[model samples]
Target: MGGSDSRCLRCGSTKSREVRIFDDPQSLSEAVAASNMPKEIADELEKRISSYNLRLQKPHSAESHSSQHVAAMMDATGDDGQLTLSSLSRSLERMDIHGTTAEKLIGQAEFEGRLIREGQDTWSWLQQSS
Candidate 1:
């Protein structure tokens, strides 16, 4: 059982060697569905992924601080009226939001039409028409 060719101790099966990067729940779910991992592990992972996706899809509540953070970011657009992903992450960090929480807030903002994607990692504030 070498480093690259390790085998599962319980079942004597060769472990998968492929490395996958999943940026979203759909991709993760797809990978889990296509994997040859044990049924128990794959089922657990699928359950957790479904729960995570549900959480992300839920609407932000009125008193939710996440909504406030998004509003603040929208109001703090740069001089060029643009917001970079890095900048948004940094701002969210300052507000004690990091990792997946920050990501969810950013996604929510975009989905709510508060931020319009302008490039791969840049967005512009979607100003409300009077």
Candidate 2:
């Protein structure tokens, strides 16, 4: 058979590299274990793969994520200590949270008395009573 195409359409380069695809970390670990690679190198790869798997398994609930965003927005508030809807929207967008989820988070904050509407597009953070 003829040589495979090595040209990259976007970069217009002919350079190519071997790519290994694994369904999951377990399979990759299995492959590494079965390989004849050096012990130290294989150990390092396993460590990295284990770390990646741990991160993937970490639980991140919507409530916790929203709370974190709210805390960040509070910290970012100006001297007036007000958070604008636009600002909150931008922050949420940066966090990859948008659309109805963003709307719901805003509504939830207001419902929980964490925010008080000060104007049409602005809100003031309500400090929790001790």
Report, for every candidate in turn, its global Cα lDDT versus the true structure: 0.72, 0.73
TM-score of structure candidate 1: 0.43
If scored against the real structure, what TM-score would every candidate get? Answer: 0.43, 0.44
Q: Runs in model 2 with CA error above 4 Å?
A: 1-60, 98-102
RMSD of each: 16.8, 15.2
Clash totals in order: 0, 0
| Candidate that would win on lDDT | 2
Top model number, TM-score: 2
Alpha-carbon shift of residue 38 in model 2 (angstroms): 46
Assess the local accuracy of residue 37 in candidate 2 as a C-alpha lDDT between 0 and 100.
Answer: 84
Predicted candidate 1 versus true structure: per-residue lDDT over 94-117, tens digit per residue: 667544454566587789887778
- In the range 98-117, model 2's lDDT, one tens digit per residue, is 44444565677799888888
